[model samples]
Target: MAEVKLKNLTKRWGDFVGVDNQSLNIKDQEFLVLLGPSGCGKTTTMRMIAGLEDPTGGEIWIGDRKVNDDLPKDRDVAMVFQNYGLYPHMTIFDNIAYPLKVRGTPKDETRPRVEKAAEQVELTQFLDRKPKALSGGQRQRVALARAIVRTPKVFLMDEPLSNLDAKLRVTMRAELKHLSRALQITTVYVTHDQIEAMTLADRVAVMKHGIIQQLGTPDEIYNDPANLFVAGFIGSPAMNLINGSVRDGMFVTTGGTRLTKLPTADRARAILGVRADDMSVHEAGQGDIDVTIYAFENTGESTLLTVQWGKQRVIARGDRHLRKEQDDVVGISLDPDHLYLFDPDTEQRIRM
Candidate 1:
């Protein structure tokens, strides 16, 4: 049982707070991701778990032991950094074997473990080559092999695919998913990429300014966001937010055009949220409201239309065969079942 628990964890540098009082439980053999942008304290939280940084307050536990006072090497955790962190002078085999050797494993036992780890990462043939001769993806596998050779209690990965190119990153994402399930190690991963968090994590903790804004599965976060920040940050093109108000059981644009039926009884001011895909396009005068087209984009799988409504512009996801031009006119209707209402002042979702 390698469950991890952070109890009111915090990191403070004098007046600056890197990680506020945050508590979380990561279950055994679960793949958990800490997701947020830079300076959001995701990395700081992981470092505290790894024993690389001391917490200003709270307790760090691994299984039955409190590990706040333990050294990084004594914590029995493996970390993979963004830069690959391979030795330039040593061969790939030696690089992967370094961890085992430093821990005083016998030479005879080290060879089979190193070889098995290398084979798992598809680096067996390149074991004799130096780091300078390998590609970005190959060097990354060397780092992974080094970590897997020792069978640590927990895995801490910090943006391991950020250094790779876009195409390579996609391929590596699949590989990492496969490897994680095969090893079944309790893992804590930190990344700013939403796609990575959605695809890799069993549960994601989304943070901002040192506070966790929401924690849920990918589908829960995407389909039903807790707040404006979460709804805006999770989607690809983002959810479209229209400034409007509720009046007489209907939502009216600031321009006084009645757009759709109001879910709530009546609120003087509110924000209507809908994703591009939830909106349907039609010929002018046929839908809820007619608007002039601002721009049109074709992305192969689907087309996107940026339509002008009142003083605001909202994007609508159109069919792949859709063909429109700037200055053209079109009508957009919001799906009633998928629409969201939020209080403008508090930025929280309105249940009604």
Candidate 2:
């Protein structure tokens, strides 16, 4: 219900900088996700927003008020951590009602609100159960219900589903997205899982080495990454970075296969960046460069095929029916419209 903003926010431990000068504006009632690999400063950024970790320098604004010195409880935000942080001795009902109790709400008023929260998370039947009695997903739901009962302006979640099984995590991902939409609370979720960020966030901020690499909607981030790090990070099987040189408006690979460069303003210096799904495979032919198939993995609906052209390996997602095997020869063609061009030296996206 409230917008969250960070202005030149930074965090450092001695000489080691955890988060650099990062400025981001999370819109009111928007579901924004901070995404990156480990040690990328995502968790540090979230903790700073939740008032758990103080920033080395910069300002944090919640709604319209500056809250750099505010306590976590005074920040009007609820956090659901990876560990759930439930009191194992307390029943689910009491756990959900703890926030209201701390606020000194009368017991009569706390019960219905707690029950309503439990119902919202579909944990009404497990109200009397302890954390030890509930499954991992159920415990996560209990944690969610506890956070929801307070009805805070913002919700912060740090890899809340990482502890669950893969199947359970997928199920909970959908549930959390639906729950956030229904509650319409400003949410800031942190996770290293690209798929989770892609599926759940309205906009994802991809970070690396304490800096934001790119900030965009899922489709934008997936289709049009800002730099090579984001281009390599946001996709499954990752995008293929074929090292080639531009000559006469065409890209010449090391294996001697030449493909016409897509018409760009800076066609003189453009490196070919192609996504695995954007490349099509055909039967081996004269114009096709002979590639040694490194591996082919069947992933239910599609197959991930890895091919080595000289020393560089590139991946292509092909149809499940394409009977390719290790050491097989295949012909590949890049989808020029979907191709990304990057500066060879800086690795930044070249405007086309």
Candidate 3:
């Protein structure tokens, strides 16, 4: 396996820019994820690396060779797409064997390689079945098996789980994680799903508007976001960004409620960043601020209480067994150790 490098990489069409001068280093055998919303250029960046899209500027290096002019097939990269790019008429075995067959591998070399790849993805029993006969998850595994059959220097997966149902997506995530570790191949995964990025990535590059907002491990991006975009985009419910100002070492909300004390110096305009998990729910008047519940949700694993806090509604995570109704009064206190401050003007975190 070879490490992939992008130096000042950029993609442009006319005056519109798709990827704006982004540089990344994906180490060999590393599972790196490019995470962001649609049209954020994550897909375009991967396409450029695959030689499917032309870059306006910059170099792409795989191992010791720069592959800017290489064809997609010549780049030694296998890509699995969201739609499970497979032939409906071909048996699962044939699909997995396609890459080797196309590359002119001997018939003797093809069968065992295909069979081994199919077994790795738990598709051995379904090898004789065509893609149309398999479930969504099974089809995706066939796609993965096809990729791995090549044992390419790098694997590019683009939202390979988005088409699966929620439960199957979860199951596939675990399988994908295990497959990645076992293969020990460099992989670049693209997805807008924060949960996938958090669970699957060794390190995540969070992107927005064609720019990388933050690049770090899942813990660093979640617990210590570099900017407003990362803080808001990286979480399920997103970090609550309350409009406020810091006065005399205390943060005050727009409604004149002094929310929390800050260790940083005073800022005339700032945003207080806190996650739902960082706030503890309490009985009425038991915590720092008392407010009425705007909405209550029970999501099996945990309960979410959206409470009216001054002029804004804030969501707080409650114990799974905790039940509450709308209009119920409750108090929520912030975890001071996890609180984050950001400059509203620049959207950058204010570190003490």
**Which number leads on lDDT?**
3
- 272, model 3: CA deviation in Å? 0.4
Residues forming the 10-long window of minimal summed lDDT in candidate 1: 227-236
| Model 3 per-residue lDDT tens digits across residues 1-352 | 9999999999999988999999999999999999999999999999999999999999999999999999998999999999999988899999999999989999999999999999999999999888999999999999999999987999999999999999999999999999999999999999999999999999999998889999999999999999999999978788899999999999999999988888889878999999999999999998888889999999999999998888998889999999999999988899999998898989999997
- Model 2 spans with C-alpha error above 4 angstroms: 264-270, 286-290
Which of 2 and 3 is ahead in TM-score?
3
TM-score of each: 0.96, 0.96, 0.98
Predicted structure 2: lDDT: 0.89
Ranking according to TM-score, highest score first: 3, 1, 2
Give Cα-based local distance difference scores for all models: 0.92, 0.89, 0.94
Judged by whole-model lDDT over C-alpha atoms, candidate 3 comes out at 0.94
How would the candidate models be sorted by lDDT, starting from the highest?
3, 1, 2
Off by over 4 Å in 3: none
Clashing pairs in 3: none
As a whole number from 0 to 100, the lDDT of residue 106 in candidate 1 is 99
